[model samples]
Target: MSLSDDGGYGGDGHRGPETGQTRTRLPGGDGDLYGSGRRPRAGMSSRNLVTIVGVIVLLLAAIAFANRDGSGNSESGGDSPKDTGPGAARPTAPTGTKPVTGKNGQIASGFAKTEQGAQSAAANYAVALVSANILKPGERHAIVQQVFAPAKVDDMQSRLDAAYSTAFLKKLGLDAKGDAAPGMTYVSRTVPVGTKLVKLQGDTADLEVWCTGLFGTAGAKSTTPVTSDWFTMRLQLKWAGGDWKVDGFSQQDGPAPVNGDDKTSGADQIAKAVEQYGGFTYAR
Candidate 1:
């Protein structure tokens, strides 16, 4: 009947020879039914692993490059002078009456957006706040009034006056006005360690001035010995009067370290030294 006569078994329309199932087999060397399956050869798997490793290596390299360039980090902007911490000496102001920037090209304006600017302002302001000027009643009032915000000025001034009253001066062997005894040397020097910007926004900067100061008398026979004190001064600063101005600032003692024993100088010598050496306008 044509080729259809032998369709009973394997003659024409039969199942597979081995499994006896009707299925489609691709033309290959007895592989899987769908296609040749060589179990994803070892070479191909290794190549894929190598590709992944290469991508990871590239990512690591890019990270290293970014770090080396100092672009992706916080302190690497090329615009300002190097930050040398708080021990760095700031430039002295011309009048010796105000604060100044520490390094050249450092912007100390309160209006500055850079970190250096904020730091510089805080350091200088701290120096001004803790100067010997605060011992004088009139000057102290002026400083508090000028430095603090309008709302807080009177309260701060009264509190400061009480804090530096005749009793306080007596404790330091000074008169009511906080002047050093005539024969004894009164040492009150505030040296900034470094400044940190806690927060900075347009027209305002919140800063902390980490400072170490020498207070009391430095003379060998002095009733009050010279001592070192550490304090942090917080400042809410504003750009006003053509420079960085302190809107509200307050000081509290310590975070100080243990005392170190050092030889003491004579009172006259200490007094003379205090008279000779002047203060600085600190910058960051």
Candidate 2:
């Protein structure tokens, strides 16, 4: 990731002129996604230059705006969970011993055909999906099998492995699996900022999880220090295999707020804290 906002996907599998991972597609512009697009013009008139600059500025603004939590309907605002209908009991949690429930009385159901339960199933599954544990091989595999749709399990697992490969880790100064380096703390945490039900019909709810996560290392000489980001993870949950399982999901960058001026911690302290603190079972 680059440090500035000029970044773009150069079509060479490398991040260009920007800092973030995902690149933006200009509105109404044709893309060679398969490698075809307009060739760059070397020079242009003042009017055209100004227009181009305006477009770039607008593009960035659009990206930022689209990503803003402007709706103000976020659960973090303390809105009460709504009931879908009368006499419907709250969704159940996975039973280690008892069932779990979500914001409303609705069952946290998944696809009846998938491996997990529904909404609650999807929420819980997402927790594990973005956890620090996935840095480990065995743990990552287990998480994939448990959270993903059975039909896509193998493909997802392989893709994830490739995405989190050694080169990727090195780029972040992390070890092969996502571990923080010695004397430094590597942070890759996904906090559930809120959960919203976009649509809920029998056995399926298109749930959107608003999340904020910190990714980077804490320490002197650290190039990629910890920084926070906001993204919405949309999950297509289905009831399958006796519980709610995720059939598909996708991530889009921020409706994020401006960066806050919080005090930074020492590298060692951050590392220790990560080791000491455990994650929570996020509820709305």
Candidate 3:
């Protein structure tokens, strides 16, 4: 019953000396033992000095060239070069390939039995778990059934019901049924920023989804004005009945970025946008 945030969530370098001065012996024979009478040695020969300098210059040039940004010459033009190195950031844009084409009720289902499918399932389940739709008893039950394994649905439903109880709803200025007062819109939406596979094997995957969410009430007189929050959702999913389903999940505070000072929108404007806009079935 862990929901994403939105309130409901749950050394040193050595230096070399100069090459050059000629050593001269001191009159005292002690010079050989102590080497205290050494005189200035002749400076390095012009040819040797030039060669050494040339080698140094080449080394510097080579270093500069090696360190130059390789991104500028990318064949992709100005597009960021594809990073094939280990630990590279994932591409932000969709691959244009849908993660899953099947649906169980309104929930995306039948994800491929692959790592990508596991990620896709985790992301979509995260969205459903934190969505405003889950506020309603009917939709919550449907979400619980569709996103969790058959064995977990009943227990999950009871747990979620308690988590979203009348007291919790009241705190956010919502009725026992989880409805906002007239003229107010309750907001609870999760937008996954990215997903990472922590561990994947056989039929189980441990994933972490970084997300930003909007929650609270939107209305001129609303006490709980809609606001944004950042959080990470850790989902443990298992392949079941030919699809991936949430076996368990938990929420944690962010990996959040600093908030920007953007102009605030009016309640009506926020409500209008939410109504007009549609959410996506996220894919990895």
Candidate 4:
């Protein structure tokens, strides 16, 4: 996210990108993999060729044997644990813990002192940070104060106010108050796909939140039709007065997938769906 809106492969040879060590083919550091560019004997003997082939055959047989699966008749009768590879990612699932029944004017509050709570806080904070309500100066101030730490409220409010000015809102077909025109719905909603806790210690925690959202206007005569965006937010949270509050925020464009070929709903249908289906609290 150029501080705005936008930021993988398996362990196979084909990858999007890679990090850490690479297989060094240089001659000096690791051993030379190409046998120091030595030429083969011009008059190679048949015995040597046969011996090399035999070694290769044995090596291939050993590899095949090592990769074979069990026959399923062993006494233990259990399969081996899977190695998910170096690029395996953690799966998201419900922790089965209920969220606290608390709210600070639609924003969540009173999170527990746990990693799950930090994740939940990160998700909600990201949602509020990008909502259409941020277009309104007063609402934006309130949101910043509620989701951020007390020490950061003033700076955050000022920064957001500058980003969502009167002119910016106008460009998006919104008024000074961030409201759509009559019979129109200005859509902005962030739905977090998953959250990963990066670090947690004492009164501070860091998290990564992957999200998708709908943004634009919903009306038959609207210029900006609702479109979806995918992004990842990195949040630094601090435990304050028995709750997790946002301390730092940054975003980047997605690990997005190819768009699907789905039927586009009418503006009226889209508006009605948004109104009827309320957003979730996102406890993980």
Q: What is the C-alpha lDDT of each candidate?
A: 0.47, 0.46, 0.59, 0.57
Alpha-carbon lDDT of model 1: 0.47
Task: Write candidate 2's Cα lDDT for 121-225 as tens digits.
Answer: 545655565555655567778777776567767766665565456765564466776676776765556666666566555765566665666545555445443
What's the TM-score of every candidate structure?
Answer: 0.55, 0.59, 0.68, 0.68
On a 0 to 1 TM-score scale, where does candidate 3 land against the true structure? 0.68
Better of 3 and 4 by lDDT: 3
Q: How many backbone clashes does candidate 1 have?
A: 3
Q: What TM-score does candidate 1 reach? A: 0.55
The 10-residue segment of model 4 with minimum total lDDT is 9-18
Q: Write the per-residue lDDT of candidate 3 for residues 1-284, one digit (tens) a residue.
A: 12521222330000000121112122233212112323324443465344333322332232222223211111111223235521135775766666897877767887987767888898888888767777677888888889887777776677557555666556456788768899888776778898877667788777778877665556656544455666667777878988998876656556767555454556677778888988888887
lDDT of 4 by residue, 187-210 (tens): 777888888776677897767788
Q: How large an RMSD does model 1 have?
A: 35.2
* Superposed model 3: Cα runs more than 4 Å off: 1-8, 11-88, 92-97
Give residue 275's lDDT in candidate 2 (0 to 100). 78
Among these predictions, the greatest lDDT belongs to: 3
> Model 3 residue 39 lDDT?
35
